[model samples]
Target: MIEIYTDGASSGNPGPGGYGVVLKAGKHYKELSGGFRKTTNNRMELLAVIKGLEALKTPSHVTIWSDSKYVVDAVEKKWVFGWVKKEFKGKKNKDLWIEFLKLYKIHQIKFVWIKGHNNHPENERCDQLAVAASKDKANIGIDHFYESEQAKETLF
Candidate 1:
Protein backbone atom coordinates (compact mmCIF):
# COMPACT_ATOMS: atom_id res chain seq x y z
CA MET A 1 0.00 0.00 0.00
CA ILE A 2 1.10 3.56 -0.69
CA GLU A 3 0.93 6.26 1.95
CA ILE A 4 0.55 9.95 1.20
CA TYR A 5 0.77 12.85 3.61
CA THR A 6 -0.43 16.32 2.64
CA ASP A 7 -0.67 19.91 3.88
CA GLY A 8 -1.47 23.38 2.59
CA ALA A 9 -0.63 26.90 3.71
CA SER A 10 -1.26 30.54 2.88
CA SER A 11 0.68 33.56 4.13
CA GLY A 12 -2.49 35.60 4.39
CA ASN A 13 -6.09 34.42 4.46
CA PRO A 14 -6.34 34.91 0.74
CA GLY A 15 -2.78 35.54 -0.22
CA PRO A 16 -0.18 33.32 -1.81
CA GLY A 17 -0.82 29.65 -1.13
CA GLY A 18 0.88 26.33 -1.68
CA TYR A 19 0.41 22.56 -1.31
CA GLY A 20 2.75 19.84 -0.14
CA VAL A 21 2.60 16.08 -0.61
CA VAL A 22 4.81 13.31 0.65
CA LEU A 23 4.32 9.95 -1.05
CA LYS A 24 5.74 6.66 0.13
CA ALA A 25 5.51 3.32 -1.65
CA GLY A 26 7.51 0.43 -0.33
CA LYS A 27 10.75 1.89 1.02
CA HIS A 28 10.91 4.91 -1.32
CA TYR A 29 9.68 8.36 -0.40
CA LYS A 30 8.99 11.29 -2.73
CA GLU A 31 8.13 14.86 -1.89
CA LEU A 32 6.10 17.15 -4.11
CA SER A 33 5.08 20.75 -3.62
CA GLY A 34 4.11 23.87 -5.59
CA GLY A 35 2.67 27.29 -4.95
CA PHE A 36 0.21 29.59 -6.60
CA ARG A 37 0.85 33.32 -6.58
CA LYS A 38 -2.53 33.84 -4.91
CA THR A 39 -5.12 31.46 -3.45
CA THR A 40 -6.91 30.22 -0.36
CA ASN A 41 -5.60 27.65 2.09
CA ASN A 42 -8.56 25.33 1.36
CA ARG A 43 -7.92 25.12 -2.35
CA MET A 44 -4.32 24.25 -1.79
CA GLU A 45 -5.31 21.66 0.78
CA LEU A 46 -7.59 19.83 -1.66
CA LEU A 47 -5.02 20.20 -4.43
CA ALA A 48 -2.43 18.42 -2.32
CA VAL A 49 -4.66 15.35 -2.13
CA ILE A 50 -5.49 15.53 -5.82
CA LYS A 51 -1.86 15.79 -6.85
CA GLY A 52 -0.84 12.91 -4.62
CA LEU A 53 -3.39 10.58 -6.22
CA GLU A 54 -2.55 11.82 -9.69
CA ALA A 55 1.09 10.95 -9.08
CA LEU A 56 0.36 7.27 -8.77
CA LYS A 57 1.26 5.09 -11.76
CA THR A 58 -1.52 2.55 -11.55
CA PRO A 59 -4.79 1.88 -9.78
CA SER A 60 -3.83 0.62 -6.34
CA HIS A 61 -4.71 0.76 -2.67
CA VAL A 62 -3.62 4.01 -1.08
CA THR A 63 -4.04 5.83 2.21
CA ILE A 64 -3.93 9.61 2.51
CA TRP A 65 -3.10 11.59 5.62
CA SER A 66 -4.18 15.20 5.66
CA ASP A 67 -4.29 18.07 8.11
CA SER A 68 -7.52 19.27 6.50
CA LYS A 69 -11.11 18.69 7.51
CA TYR A 70 -12.19 20.09 4.17
CA VAL A 71 -10.63 17.24 2.27
CA VAL A 72 -11.08 14.44 4.76
CA ASP A 73 -14.73 14.98 5.65
CA ALA A 74 -15.73 15.39 2.03
CA VAL A 75 -14.39 11.94 1.27
CA GLU A 76 -14.66 10.05 4.54
CA LYS A 77 -18.22 11.19 4.93
CA LYS A 78 -19.03 10.94 1.20
CA TRP A 79 -19.95 14.58 0.64
CA VAL A 80 -17.68 15.08 -2.35
CA PHE A 81 -19.61 12.88 -4.73
CA GLY A 82 -22.87 14.48 -3.70
CA TRP A 83 -21.42 17.92 -4.29
CA VAL A 84 -20.30 16.82 -7.72
CA LYS A 85 -23.79 15.57 -8.44
CA LYS A 86 -25.07 19.02 -7.54
CA GLU A 87 -22.52 20.55 -9.92
CA PHE A 88 -20.57 22.01 -7.01
CA LYS A 89 -23.00 24.84 -6.27
CA GLY A 90 -22.32 26.58 -2.94
CA LYS A 91 -19.27 24.43 -2.32
CA LYS A 92 -15.62 25.46 -2.16
CA ASN A 93 -12.54 24.07 -3.91
CA LYS A 94 -14.45 23.02 -7.02
CA ASP A 95 -11.40 22.86 -9.23
CA LEU A 96 -9.52 20.45 -7.03
CA TRP A 97 -12.68 18.53 -6.29
CA ILE A 98 -13.24 17.90 -9.97
CA GLU A 99 -9.67 16.71 -10.34
CA PHE A 100 -10.00 14.51 -7.30
CA LEU A 101 -13.12 12.79 -8.63
CA LYS A 102 -11.22 11.78 -11.74
CA LEU A 103 -8.62 9.86 -9.78
CA TYR A 104 -11.00 8.65 -7.09
CA LYS A 105 -12.65 6.27 -9.52
CA ILE A 106 -9.43 4.51 -10.39
CA HIS A 107 -7.89 3.84 -7.03
CA GLN A 108 -8.98 2.30 -3.76
CA ILE A 109 -8.39 5.35 -1.66
CA LYS A 110 -8.84 6.15 2.02
CA PHE A 111 -8.35 9.37 3.92
CA VAL A 112 -7.18 9.83 7.50
CA TRP A 113 -7.24 13.17 9.27
CA ILE A 114 -4.23 14.20 11.32
CA LYS A 115 -4.20 17.10 13.72
CA GLY A 116 -2.19 19.94 12.24
CA HIS A 117 0.73 21.46 14.20
CA ASN A 118 0.45 18.55 16.63
CA ASN A 119 3.92 17.16 15.93
CA HIS A 120 2.88 14.43 13.49
CA PRO A 121 6.15 14.20 11.59
CA GLU A 122 4.79 13.74 8.07
CA ASN A 123 2.09 16.38 8.44
CA GLU A 124 4.56 18.84 9.95
CA ARG A 125 7.00 18.24 7.11
CA CYS A 126 4.23 18.88 4.61
CA ASP A 127 3.34 22.12 6.36
CA GLN A 128 6.97 23.25 6.16
CA LEU A 129 7.07 22.49 2.45
CA ALA A 130 3.80 24.30 1.79
CA VAL A 131 4.84 27.39 3.70
CA ALA A 132 8.24 27.54 2.05
CA ALA A 133 6.84 27.11 -1.46
CA SER A 134 4.18 29.78 -0.95
CA LYS A 135 6.92 32.25 -0.02
CA ASP A 136 9.25 31.55 -2.93
CA LYS A 137 9.58 34.47 -5.32
CA ALA A 138 9.19 32.46 -8.52
CA ASN A 139 5.69 31.05 -7.99
CA ILE A 140 3.71 31.15 -11.25
CA GLY A 141 0.45 29.34 -10.62
CA ILE A 142 -2.79 31.32 -10.49
CA ASP A 143 -5.94 30.68 -8.50
CA HIS A 144 -9.10 31.81 -10.28
CA PHE A 145 -11.07 32.10 -7.06
CA TYR A 146 -8.26 34.05 -5.49
CA GLU A 147 -8.39 36.58 -8.31
CA SER A 148 -12.18 36.67 -8.23
CA GLU A 149 -12.24 37.18 -4.49
CA GLN A 150 -9.61 39.88 -4.80
CA ALA A 151 -11.72 41.63 -7.40
CA LYS A 152 -14.68 41.60 -5.02
CA GLU A 153 -12.52 42.95 -2.22
CA THR A 154 -11.39 45.83 -4.39
CA LEU A 155 -15.01 46.94 -4.79
CA PHE A 156 -15.37 47.50 -1.04
Candidate 2:
Protein backbone atom coordinates (compact mmCIF):
# COMPACT_ATOMS: atom_id res chain seq x y z
CA MET A 1 0.00 0.00 0.00
CA ILE A 2 1.12 3.54 -0.67
CA GLU A 3 0.91 6.16 2.07
CA ILE A 4 0.74 9.86 1.33
CA TYR A 5 1.05 12.71 3.81
CA THR A 6 0.00 16.18 2.72
CA ASP A 7 -0.27 19.77 3.96
CA GLY A 8 -1.04 23.23 2.61
CA ALA A 9 -0.46 26.87 3.58
CA SER A 10 -1.34 30.38 2.40
CA SER A 11 -0.22 33.79 3.60
CA GLY A 12 -3.76 35.07 3.06
CA ASN A 13 -7.03 33.33 2.23
CA PRO A 14 -6.38 34.10 -1.45
CA GLY A 15 -2.77 35.05 -1.28
CA PRO A 16 0.38 33.08 -1.98
CA GLY A 17 -0.36 29.37 -1.43
CA GLY A 18 1.42 26.05 -1.68
CA TYR A 19 0.94 22.31 -1.09
CA GLY A 20 3.30 19.62 0.12
CA VAL A 21 3.03 15.86 -0.33
CA VAL A 22 5.18 12.95 0.84
CA LEU A 23 4.63 9.60 -0.83
CA LYS A 24 5.92 6.41 0.73
CA ALA A 25 5.73 2.80 -0.39
CA GLY A 26 7.80 0.03 1.04
CA LYS A 27 11.31 1.47 0.86
CA HIS A 28 10.59 4.10 -1.77
CA TYR A 29 9.79 7.68 -0.80
CA LYS A 30 9.21 10.94 -2.63
CA GLU A 31 8.31 14.53 -1.77
CA LEU A 32 6.33 16.89 -3.99
CA SER A 33 5.51 20.56 -3.58
CA GLY A 34 4.59 23.66 -5.55
CA GLY A 35 3.57 27.27 -4.99
CA PHE A 36 0.90 29.44 -6.57
CA ARG A 37 0.99 33.19 -6.90
CA LYS A 38 -2.63 33.48 -5.65
CA THR A 39 -4.87 30.77 -4.30
CA THR A 40 -6.70 29.57 -1.20
CA ASN A 41 -5.57 27.28 1.61
CA ASN A 42 -8.39 24.86 0.78
CA ARG A 43 -7.25 24.74 -2.85
CA MET A 44 -3.76 23.94 -1.76
CA GLU A 45 -5.05 21.27 0.60
CA LEU A 46 -6.99 19.52 -2.14
CA LEU A 47 -4.20 20.02 -4.63
CA ALA A 48 -1.73 18.29 -2.34
CA VAL A 49 -3.83 15.14 -2.47
CA ILE A 50 -4.25 15.49 -6.22
CA LYS A 51 -0.53 15.87 -6.75
CA GLY A 52 0.21 12.82 -4.65
CA LEU A 53 -2.23 10.70 -6.58
CA GLU A 54 -1.02 12.03 -9.90
CA ALA A 55 2.54 11.07 -9.11
CA LEU A 56 1.59 7.40 -8.89
CA LYS A 57 2.53 5.63 -12.13
CA THR A 58 0.05 2.84 -11.65
CA PRO A 59 -3.17 2.00 -9.88
CA SER A 60 -2.82 0.84 -6.28
CA HIS A 61 -4.32 0.96 -2.81
CA VAL A 62 -3.50 4.31 -1.27
CA THR A 63 -3.99 6.08 2.03
CA ILE A 64 -3.95 9.85 2.13
CA TRP A 65 -3.16 11.76 5.31
CA SER A 66 -4.26 15.37 5.47
CA ASP A 67 -4.60 18.05 8.14
CA SER A 68 -7.53 19.78 6.43
CA LYS A 69 -11.05 18.65 7.18
CA TYR A 70 -12.09 20.46 4.05
CA VAL A 71 -10.12 17.89 2.09
CA VAL A 72 -10.77 14.82 4.26
CA ASP A 73 -14.44 15.22 5.18
CA ALA A 74 -15.47 16.03 1.65
CA VAL A 75 -14.26 12.62 0.51
CA GLU A 76 -14.84 10.59 3.68
CA LYS A 77 -18.32 12.08 4.20
CA LYS A 78 -19.33 11.89 0.50
CA TRP A 79 -19.98 15.60 0.02
CA VAL A 80 -17.98 15.70 -3.17
CA PHE A 81 -20.19 13.10 -4.82
CA GLY A 82 -23.24 15.16 -4.05
CA TRP A 83 -21.55 18.21 -5.47
CA VAL A 84 -20.76 16.24 -8.60
CA LYS A 85 -24.38 15.25 -9.11
CA LYS A 86 -25.30 18.88 -8.89
CA GLU A 87 -22.62 19.66 -11.48
CA PHE A 88 -20.58 21.46 -8.84
CA LYS A 89 -22.84 24.45 -8.77
CA GLY A 90 -21.96 26.93 -6.02
CA LYS A 91 -18.81 25.00 -5.25
CA LYS A 92 -15.34 26.38 -4.93
CA ASN A 93 -12.37 24.70 -6.63
CA LYS A 94 -14.42 22.94 -9.24
CA ASP A 95 -11.43 22.61 -11.53
CA LEU A 96 -9.36 20.82 -8.95
CA TRP A 97 -12.25 18.66 -7.75
CA ILE A 98 -12.96 17.42 -11.25
CA GLU A 99 -9.33 16.59 -11.77
CA PHE A 100 -9.16 14.80 -8.43
CA LEU A 101 -12.23 12.67 -9.17
CA LYS A 102 -10.81 11.55 -12.49
CA LEU A 103 -7.64 10.31 -10.85
CA TYR A 104 -9.56 9.05 -7.81
CA LYS A 105 -11.58 6.65 -9.97
CA ILE A 106 -8.44 5.01 -11.26
CA HIS A 107 -7.27 3.80 -7.85
CA GLN A 108 -8.47 2.65 -4.47
CA ILE A 109 -8.09 5.57 -2.12
CA LYS A 110 -8.72 6.35 1.55
CA PHE A 111 -8.35 9.57 3.51
CA VAL A 112 -7.28 10.10 7.12
CA TRP A 113 -7.58 13.44 8.88
CA ILE A 114 -5.09 14.65 11.45
CA LYS A 115 -4.78 17.81 13.50
CA GLY A 116 -2.47 20.43 12.01
CA HIS A 117 0.69 21.63 13.79
CA ASN A 118 0.33 18.72 16.20
CA ASN A 119 3.96 17.62 15.91
CA HIS A 120 3.40 14.56 13.73
CA PRO A 121 6.69 13.95 11.94
CA GLU A 122 5.46 13.47 8.36
CA ASN A 123 2.80 16.13 8.75
CA GLU A 124 5.33 18.56 10.12
CA ARG A 125 7.64 17.92 7.20
CA CYS A 126 4.80 18.49 4.76
CA ASP A 127 3.87 21.70 6.54
CA GLN A 128 7.44 22.90 6.33
CA LEU A 129 7.56 22.16 2.60
CA ALA A 130 4.26 23.90 1.98
CA VAL A 131 5.23 27.02 3.95
CA ALA A 132 8.57 27.21 2.23
CA ALA A 133 7.02 26.83 -1.22
CA SER A 134 4.51 29.58 -0.51
CA LYS A 135 7.36 31.92 0.39
CA ASP A 136 9.39 31.05 -2.71
CA LYS A 137 8.65 33.93 -5.05
CA ALA A 138 11.12 32.87 -7.73
CA ASN A 139 9.49 29.56 -8.52
CA ILE A 140 5.87 30.50 -7.82
CA GLY A 141 3.31 29.42 -10.44
CA ILE A 142 -0.04 30.93 -11.31
CA ASP A 143 -3.40 29.39 -10.52
CA HIS A 144 -4.96 30.66 -13.72
CA PHE A 145 -8.49 29.43 -13.03
CA TYR A 146 -8.45 30.93 -9.53
CA GLU A 147 -7.04 34.25 -10.65
CA SER A 148 -9.49 34.51 -13.53
CA GLU A 149 -12.39 33.65 -11.25
CA GLN A 150 -11.28 36.26 -8.77
CA ALA A 151 -11.09 38.79 -11.56
CA LYS A 152 -14.66 38.01 -12.55
CA GLU A 153 -15.81 38.28 -8.95
CA THR A 154 -14.27 41.70 -8.63
CA LEU A 155 -16.18 42.90 -11.67
CA PHE A 156 -19.54 42.15 -10.06
The lDDT leader among the candidates is 2
Poorest 10 consecutive residues of model 1 by lDDT? 137-146
lDDT of 1 at 116: 99
- Model 1: lDDT to the true structure: 0.89
Top-TM-score candidate index? 2
The alpha-carbon RMSD values of the candidates against the true structure, listed in the order shown, are 2.0, 0.6
Model 2: lDDT of residue 150: 95
Q: Whole-model lDDT for model 2 versus the true structure?
A: 0.96
Candidate 1 error regions (>4 Å) = 145-156
Assess candidate 1 and give its TM-score to the true structure. 0.91
Residue-wise C-alpha lDDT for candidate 1, range 1-156, written one tens digit per residue = 999999999988778889999999999899999998888899889989888988999998999999899889989999988998999998876777888888999999999999999999999999999988898877658777668766887999
Q: What are the models' TM-scores?
A: 0.91, 0.99
